[model samples]
Target: MATEFEMKEIKSGDPEAARHSSMAAPQKSVTVKFENLNYSVSIKAKKTVTEKVILNNVSGMFKPGKFTAIMGNSGSGKTSLLNAGAVKGGKISGDLIINGEKMDTKFMKKMSAFVMQDDVILGTMTVREAITMSALLRLPPEIPKSEKLDRVDEIISMLRLDKAQNTVIGSTRVKGVSGGERKRTGNLIIFKIPAMAMEMVTNPSIILLDEPTSGLDSFTAYSVCTTLSDLAEQGRTVVATIHQPSSDIFLIFDDLLLLSEGRVAYYGPSSAVIDYFTKIDYPFPDYVNPADFIFMHILNNSEEAKQADKKKDALNKVLLEWDNSENKKVMLNTPATQKGLPADVMKVNASFYEQFRFLLTRAGKNVWRNALMVRARLGQAVFLGILLGLVYRDVSSRPLKSQTQALGIFLASVFEDVQVALFLAPMLIMPMMVFSGFLINNNNIPVYFNWIKYLSPIKYGFTAAAKNEFQGLVMTDQFGSLTGEKVLDDLAFTDELPVDQNLYVLLSMFIILIGMAYMALWRATKKVV
Candidate 1:
């Protein structure tokens, strides 16, 4: 039951070409295929909350290389469907297939690239760096660095991002690229944007993009459509949930799979959508786009648009019949037979590195590129050391010096506090670094107080200062003699020992503080992601 567009586009110009395309289809297939795939998410009811049914037994074949749009009103299961297909922990019951092989729920994550509605780009990377880092992490090792750069270059070229190629991607406050540019970069890193497609090896055969043009202008949205259409032409399955696209973008779709209250109301060629509605007596208005018309119709119906209701019975019956009919199953299966494979089918060894050189190169590149950042940070450490050393320069064998040095050592311990804070900086500032060193990852900030977190840098820079300030000091006071505890009670304890025991202890504290901070950072990012 592949839609006509999917079938026609693949079978269009040359039969031999179509055959080759089919051979390239992803291996594996899905079962009972979303048979009764329904879901609901609970929300707290007291805080102006709304209850929603995200999806309802909506099923369809996701053929390789076919561009499909999952059309629906806001809160419909479009995003839910994509999430279910990609991420897990949903209330799922249907089977997803690939080449007749049942898609193991546990393995679905490895098989899909899900670009969420909100752009998930880290704010500090340049376009090429983001894409390159992603390539290093995910691309098959068969693609070399030279080829990877070429691939990045091609994607940058394809996106018409030549002007902003070297621009940093971040918010306006941080000063860098524009929103569209950053969105594209984020997508590129995750393989939703065109720039990363050329060298993508670990990319899922089926791409699920949620609102690929959610925040763009008409022209930009159109550009996104064109890019996706080009991907489809190249024989990759593209599924996107979009809203309010202009007519120009509407036409680029091969199929429009419309949803209403979690049900498939229309799943066919974009050209035939209006006719399908007209045939069902819910004709589109004279000037209304069919996409808009359908959304209006569903919205007017509300949550009460039950299949068995009689007032709007004609529309509901027709759509429901279509869903239950054997023809729909045929539509679901057509892609398989056309490609000579089943759904949920997987092929192509996603394992990119089976060799040592490949892994070492990735590791080496990571270390090399980070060399400057690391050194600059370490230089800050040395500067802190000078400052602290100067601050505690007067520690001596006298009682006054012992008291002063003891206080200095305590202030130096603040460096340990600062070191702890510095390591935590990466946890908050670059969590994804723990993953692939690609971009800085910031967790969600509360709407009211996020600004405070944005300006704080005390955690990262203070520790280095403390460690450099307090090592190798002999401060003696009469209090040590008076107390008989040698705790700086008297100035009696002068030391040749400052360079040995005291220095070693101070150095140990420095190393210990740094080690603790680094370990904390590693664990935080690992756990957070």
Candidate 2:
């Protein structure tokens, strides 16, 4: 019952394919086996909190040269199970082994390429640029640039993306590559069988995908599955959580692991699924797709009180049957081996300097391409500078009238700029500006409110600006004339912080604030689970 798309030429013997082919020699294989895996999270409601189990004692095996599909109804722990196996977060209790060796999540993350359901692609870059950048950053630094470029070209050809290789991987704001093409641009770490073929550079032994065909047409989904099949054929152990797939799509999978209520309903070869279910008295109807038939029986769709009970009973029965099956014993009893695969080999090959250079170049390109945003920021800076200058004008000529005004302008400018750059609200920034000792003299201000001035960067800038303008000038009121020293005493500027001291404090504040801002930006950009 294979469709035309399913039977289309697989390009298995192409030069690009041959380069990745495992048939030439028996490539190193990875076998992932999990036993008694349980995942849970604490949930709070009103005044009470409880633990919700996501995966309950789930056990299975994923072997190289096979495509294993994990499928379930909504809220059936499909994503949680995938995350438990591939990601290191949440509370998980399990025995996860790779190649008969107990492997930690960190080690697994390096050895496996996890293609998330969502496309994590740089929208600005063309298809070729995105893939090439990933290759440069990920492929061993020891490899020559030419060889890397050749690898990228080979991947581009292998994935059949030559037609749109130069097209931008656009965002919602901009039109770029087609949806199918975007789906191919997956995460860099793990082997994702997307159109970009980014993981081929690493030749990872294990590839894990979450809903690889969730947002594609039947034909595109079939093509994606075919690509995964080809990768599996080359000795990669491919595991993906698939949604309701078409009959042709189902045929592509070598093994199936179906879940119900966080418990395994079935796990076996795709070909034996119909027969297995029939033996359990859940016979398939005539001319119905096996995937659809299985979903209809396992998933709870009934709203009727009586039918709901029947569905629950049927699901429980299936779970109990799986618990008693011989397959469960075989999967849980797999022995651990002494394979020594160093976790460092899976670590990013580029040195820290190389990584920094690559990131800096990419960031520069992104900023340069967004010309409108850069120009707008520059315009704002110029306007603010001009405004500050105008407000602080004539400080020397009219020292008495403009000295305090200049101090206020400098303080406000420095404080406001820092606040805006840090994304602080005006409501929060206004209080700091008011307490900076510009409008209210620090000595005259109440004792309790005076401490706010100590924390203000504006205080340093104001003192520095006032001393620079009025240090040696003469100040006069209508009644009398006063020396700059007298004026400094009147404003409490002659006490502890001199002009040089104020300037140094302001410089320190600037450096500290800028460093904090950079750290915030770095954390924001870093990937967190």
**Alpha-carbon lDDT, every model:** 0.55, 0.73
- Deviation from truth (RMSD, Å), model 1: 11.2
Cα misplacement distance, residue 106 of candidate 1 (Å): 6.9
Local accuracy of candidate 1 as per-residue lDDT tens digits, 136-187 = 5555555676765666666666666779877766653346788777666555
Best by lDDT: 2
Q: After superposition, how far is residue 436 of candidate 2 from its true place, in Å?
A: 2.1
Estimate the TM-score of every prediction: 0.64, 0.84
Please provide, for model 2 over 1-529, each residue's C-alpha lDDT reduced to its tens digit, 9 standing for 90 to 100: 3211232233323324324433221236678888889999779899998999999999998877889999888888987887777754557898878877786666675677667766667677788888888778887878898988887787776666789899987776546899887787653323222323666666677787888887888877777788788788777789888879887778778889999889898887777777767777777776577778778776564557667877888878888988998877875675533255544555557787888998888888766666566898899889877877777665544445765566455656574467454677777666667777666777888888887787776777777766766778776667667676766677788874887887788788779978998898777533232
